[model samples]
Target chain A: MEPAEVEFLAEKEPVTVIPNFSLDKIYLIGGDLGPFNPGLPMEVPLWLAVNLKQRQKCRIVPPEWMDVEKLEEIREQERREDTFTPMPSPHYMELTKLLLNHASDNIPKADEIRTLVKDIWDTRLAKLRLSADRFVREQETYAKLDNLTLMEINTTAAFFTESLNHMYKLRTNLQPSEGAESQEY
Target chain B: MADELELFEQGSDAGSDEVLLTPAELIHQLEEAWLNEKFAPDLLESKSEIVECVIEQLSHMEENLQRAKKGDLKVSIHRMEIDRIRYVLSSYLRSRLLKIEKFFPHVVEKEKLRAKEDPSALSPEEFAFAKEYLENTEMFLKNVTLKHMPPNLQSIDLLKSVPQPNLDSFVFLRVKERQENILIEPETDEQREYTVDLEEGSQHLIRYKTIAPLVTSGAVQLI
Candidate 1:
């Protein structure tokens, strides 16, 4: 789901409504990088709040049109079936990176974003550690093979491909926005 | 969903699209607050303890309302992103799980084939590969499920503490679930709970039941 879409629902109520001043507003209000401008410490908690919320709602399927009630049902069903798994969507993963990139450079919310990255990892530690151990064993297994059947090679190859993608997404989503992308703010 | 930012940009009725703060307005508010002594007091004293307490109650109710309307948007998104990764991993696991489960059957089949004079001799290399595959596959699966670690272990770190107000508002989420009469005790009053079904990853907003709007048609607060 798009951040804008998420923001739309968040905005429906007035109490939590955040103002929508543009970038120009940032310059106008925060003021130019002048001596008088009191550089505010980043709102680390706010950014963390956003990212952590994303992690809490991680599910196994993409949310194309499913509502909250339907999504919960799906979660419950998957749990009952013992097939529930958690992974990140490639599309949102990219957006998350975009968010990180933007936050690092432009948004003063970098501290909060940093906290968020830490939080997501905390929630998925079990899964991540398991994945690491599995990878080590797979490498050892693959090395022992002298002559392999077509099927054996195919299976190993597929596993590697999947593992690689999973790891990439995890790293991108879980990594903090620091020196990787240089944003002057 | 329409990009909330664009809605803020155009300033026309975003057709139900809402934004946290118009970037400009938020920044302006922040600047104004800076000009005032608000930050000084917040910095000097413990960070707005009283305000934080009030907010904690407010946010709990707010989170419930939002979740009911949007059906836990954050979780929904995380789950979908996970699907792409899970697809590949699940297939790999199924194949390996099946292979392991059929290990004894395969051995018997090979023996039977040999007895029939259809010698499908298995090489040492083949034997080793099969054994290694199962061992590693099992290891990998266990790690992903956190079977090796405590189930409730704080596996991932949170970006921020849950807003206290958001927590307070969360009572509304429960109201949707049971539909039982919400018990509102003065000391430990729980707000009404509601649940929204998101079959197609779609949801709408639910106006909060308890607390009235705070900002009331004024410029948004920067902090």
Candidate 2:
């Protein structure tokens, strides 16, 4: 049964309902399902409903209440295959070195180590924000790239995709050092 | 009061280490605080004080979430959102720390070589660059604010909107946008249709920006 049926069962029965085992399981997102899949009683696969467009074969059954074009645009973005380019930030080399060194040796000052890594992470992010802001600020200049000899728009997209990938990688890598805080209930 | 004391004792019990509050429970606590403020002001010093205490505990929890990322602490999946927001807020600060750590070797090298030199010997450009660097870093961080609708937005009728396949995503607005009815299982000819009706005054705060993102194949719906 789909996530909805399982959620309904959860309410009525108050028992943990695991999704029917499908050998040909669709990997919604990468990594082990350990964190997300804790049976029905906890998370009722809200992502399955919200993360609709990302599904391989499922088409979005549009609601009758909102704009159709907006829905389509979101779907298109979800399905879009972005080209990757390595837009290494200036500080990427420095940050990697620091992380490698610290991870190698058990740093005594955990807070200090966290602070150091975070600063580098922010620097890269700043460069990314600045780039986006610049594009908006100089939209005329950016748009004019279409007419120019060089393909500046493609370059900008490449830069953004690369920067974002690096930022995400840095985040995932750095995540291991930082302790988990029980901020919620 | 006796039950409350019992619960406190139960919470610290070695066998009951698994005992933890659910998201619903946390929301209820906030609601209790809000209710206490409105109708039972004398029951507590103030509502804001209780909320502040909750927020403070949440902030501490956020820190632990960060540490969890480092493999230093174990975290359950449910608490991820709370941690995610905290990380988003502190991302800039973390980035600043990272920059310092990354450039430490260079800084140390420069310092060692220049140790014999006088502090005033450095040119004004060097000092200005240092100041500009710090300021830019701070500016970049201040901009990274959380933009998503907070969990509190779903507070009013959180339970009513249960997740069900073909369960209508359209709640506040009219039933149909462009299509006749939203199809949950189009191939199987299964569909759940509902009309959207919205309140007047809530339009300023809440309106159909877009249909909630649909999840699966054959899950077709109108805006």
- Candidate lDDT scores, in order, read 0.29, 0.29
Model 1 stretches with alpha carbons more than 4 Å out: A1-30, A34-96, A99-185, B1-207, B213-223
User: Which residue segments of model 2 deviate by more than 4 Å?
Assistant: A1-185, B1-24, B32-45, B70-80, B83-223
**Which lDDT tens digits does candidate 2 get at residues A69-166?**
43334334323423212222222223223323323232244344344444434443444455466644432111111111011222244344344334
TM-score of chain A of 1: 0.23
lDDT of 1 by residue, B1-223 (tens): 1111222221223233344543233333322322121111111111122223223323443454456446543334333323422332333234333333344234323434565333222323334554566456456546775475677852432112111111111100111112222223221123233332312221111222221111111111111
| DockQ list for all candidates | 0.03, 0.02
For B1-223, candidate 2 gives per-residue lDDT tens digits of 0011111111212233332443334434444333222211011211232234345556665665666555221243325434433432243223333333333323233434664422321224333443455455435434442223365542221112211111211111112123323322211123233333322211110111123321111011111
Q: How well is each residue in A1-185 modelled by candidate 1, as lDDT tens digits?
A: 12432332222111111212111111111112111112322221122224423443111111231223433443444335422133222122223343444334333444554444334333334333444466454332111111121222222333443454344345346343321222111
